[model samples]
Target: MSQHVLALPSPIDLAAAAFTLPLFSLVLAALIIAGTLFVPRLHNRAGGTASPTAPVTARYRPEHRALGISAIAVILVFAVENIVRGYLLNLSDIVEWWQYATPIFAAVLCLAMTLALIVLKGAHQPERPVVPTTRRTWLSFSPRAVLIGASAAFIALLGTTVAAGLASSSDDRGRFIYLEIPVPNTEIEPLRPWFYGWDFGVPVLICLAALAVVTWATLRRNAMRPYLRPETVTAERLARIQVASGAVSIATAAVLLALGGAFRFIGRSGSLSQLTIGNDDTIYDMVWKYAEFAAVARYLAPALEITGFVLLLFVAIRLLHRPTPEGHGLRPQPSAQPETVR
Candidate 1:
């Protein structure tokens, strides 16, 4: 079959086009915040006495809601700043060190906020039971799916970055490319598109390592905090875990999405055609032979991103838009049996 060559856009154009995902995400996050606040609360259960855990849920729910909102807000703000910085400074046309560090900074900031929210939620709560009634820990209540998925995504991002860095054949200024193709018996040569972590994975990896430490330490602190009711604390703790987990899941996935998508789109586009060797099957064959991973990444990047986002979104909404117990939907009233506690 004959190869069809197409002209690839400049670095500026490529990066500008790639900004679409972050832009869409920002808008979606804004809508999420608005919906969380403005949408009227709905009730689904019949009248029943509030559980021993109801007050804990009631007290922390708004804080978690704010956390959820703020998680997305951080993404939105960083995204805007990233876009503005790229365009105004014309950084999109060339590689720069700041490009790699900026996203990591955003993720770290989001994680810190989540930890702060957790601290704030437990500040006024009672201490843990002196006599252990249950053996439950943070791990038991944590959202395993989210934690696992985020961990996996982080590993995948690291792998791709390392692979790209190893494969890099040239670094012009700050821009790094996996390889450059030269026309047979000619002076013409072409550069491949950008991939995340190429020639700059060290700083990114360092930042990620710090994030992991912060997350572990904060969750540990959360586990040690007291509960309103030990037996009924599962729901409350799980909700708290979801708050931190959701933020983390979103942040990790967003970084992977932004960086991975940037890599794949540009690489795939460059592979499909070249300016110097238009419609030359040799060029296409060379690109495919050398950068075979792009073929798989084209699909994998988006699929992982969607999976992470959907999973996090489901759990986040579950925690944020909790179903109000029928009796608690309207207002507070003294239970008929005030002394008949759990």
Candidate 2:
């Protein structure tokens, strides 16, 4: 019988774990704080009546409030779980299955929440046919404008990141490191350009498309205002949906961008280390460069996400408080009869 020996993890892997735990904790804290501030406000506003006799609005309020509460609850749970995981990682060498499954659980919750919002009752109302009119477009203080601008900025950032990666000598074809255990000899695998594009580029483009669609919907809904059902599909409802979707999209894009930037920096450092191994400057210099870049990304990514969340909250509040236009209330106006000749 041959005895088996278990090898311990590398120091570098442990160091990376320690670094990521704090970084993730900070991001989660930011998200939880933001949700705590905004979700309650949204929930409160959901209870307010848009019109005195709007039964549909009254009935829909509870569900809206529930959705807001559920979202906030999820964030709270995620934050708590993250903190616990960080603590446990420090205490024990053994990784639990739940730690690995946390992300999968979070993703499932998000998908379920999205599906609930989509299939939830009170989404549709009887369509009111009215003539559509064009309104003068103004970019100032407009949610649609903000979304469009943000989408464009994300696209631009994606392009810049791609260009940066492409121009890097380190990014030359057939240059990647793959880890192999037990076997002493292993060659570095090729990190194809498509991998970077697929990881970062696809997400940015998807978010861009989502923002574009939301912007279009906003414009269409505003232009066809008299035609949309006032009781159910109000401007405020549309704004709420947009805010939720926008927050998700913005956060996702920022995270992906940060990850892509960090990876590119690390890749460059790895390549530099390989080149400067026997030189006067050691690999630590290359590592320092990556650390500096990652530090900037750590703060910048959260700031961007928080800013987007705040902006969306502001938009949602504005839409919720917007005054109902004349003839747009729940009570239908009496149609004037043709005057008969006496």
Candidate 3:
């Protein structure tokens, strides 16, 4: 029997691939935010000014500053998380559960931080408005289709996690299983990669729980905050909604990418297990149909990851956009009229 030498990936390469998305997210957010600093803030039309056409001086709201700070905090925390994970990955050759959980966890953290900042922004609303206005719910500002899509994506994530847990065997840990195949007339048996299962589903589920909690709090807080005039209220809500939308988009992308990764690995394992050294081999342990299913499933991975990357870029674009002013800070002052000889 000839010795079969197989080439395998180094631990460092695998670690780098695992961390690529997270690092990309952090850098992208930072660059976009930094670029946004150059964009000038818009001012509302002046009221009771000598010139009605003149623009009012822009008032820097504390809420905007707080929101910006929170965004910065998110990327910083994620950077720290990547550093720790890289250290841990370096310490061991074995794939750990945390490695798989890292990107999804970062996505969830982003969502939570974004929502928390929105709530903080609402808290800083001025007590007195230029005109009396009724309190408005956050739902009024939110796009219903987007909310529905986000919910669906979250539910799909849960379903995928459950499927991964059920499909995974505890004995293999998180790595793909190796099966022994024998060459006839010889005592030699070769081990090859086979079925894949995820043991880190529980950690992902926990992250999802945190995400749900944060989303609930944001909605509740936004509805309870005092309202300003329709014009002011609309602009603020739009800003909040844009931020929130970006968060949701990234979260949804995370879910898709996670599902795709799980499917891809499972399919690859299944397909690789079908390798035969001789024409008549006796390693029929894997179900042919299941392997085929996984093979088909793997095709979805690239598409999912691409979609996720697009969403990340969308987040960058959203961050670069500053909200336009809908109205002046105070009611438009009456324009000076030409004094007539009386």
Question: Which candidate ranks first by lDDT, i.e. highest?
Answer: 1
lDDT of each residue in 1-342, candidate 3, tens digit only:
999989899998875464444455345444554554465441111111111111211222333333344334434444566577666546444445554455567666655655565566556656444342444455644567767876886786687667655655544354523323333445554444433344456766787677666655565554455444333443444444544455556666666555555565655665443334477675544333355666666665655555555455445443533444442223342542221111
C-alpha RMSD values across all candidates: 7.9, 11.8, 10.0
Cα error, candidate 2, residue 93 (Å)? 22
Selected candidate, larger TM-score, 1 vs 2 = 1
lDDT of 2 by residue, 230-281 (tens): 3333433343443344334333333333433334333433333232325558
Clashing pairs in 2: none
**Residue 310 error, candidate 1, Å:** 4.2
Instruction: Give the local distance difference test score of model 1.
Output: 0.53
TM-score of each: 0.66, 0.42, 0.60
Better of 2 and 3 by TM-score: 3
Off by over 4 Å in 2: 1-53, 56-145, 168-299, 305-342
Candidate 2: give its CA RMSD in angstroms.
11.8
Q: What value does the lDDT take at residue 20 in candidate 2?
A: 46
Backbone N/Cα/C clashes per model: 0, 0, 3
Q: Please state the error at residue 229 of candidate 1 in Å.
A: 3.7
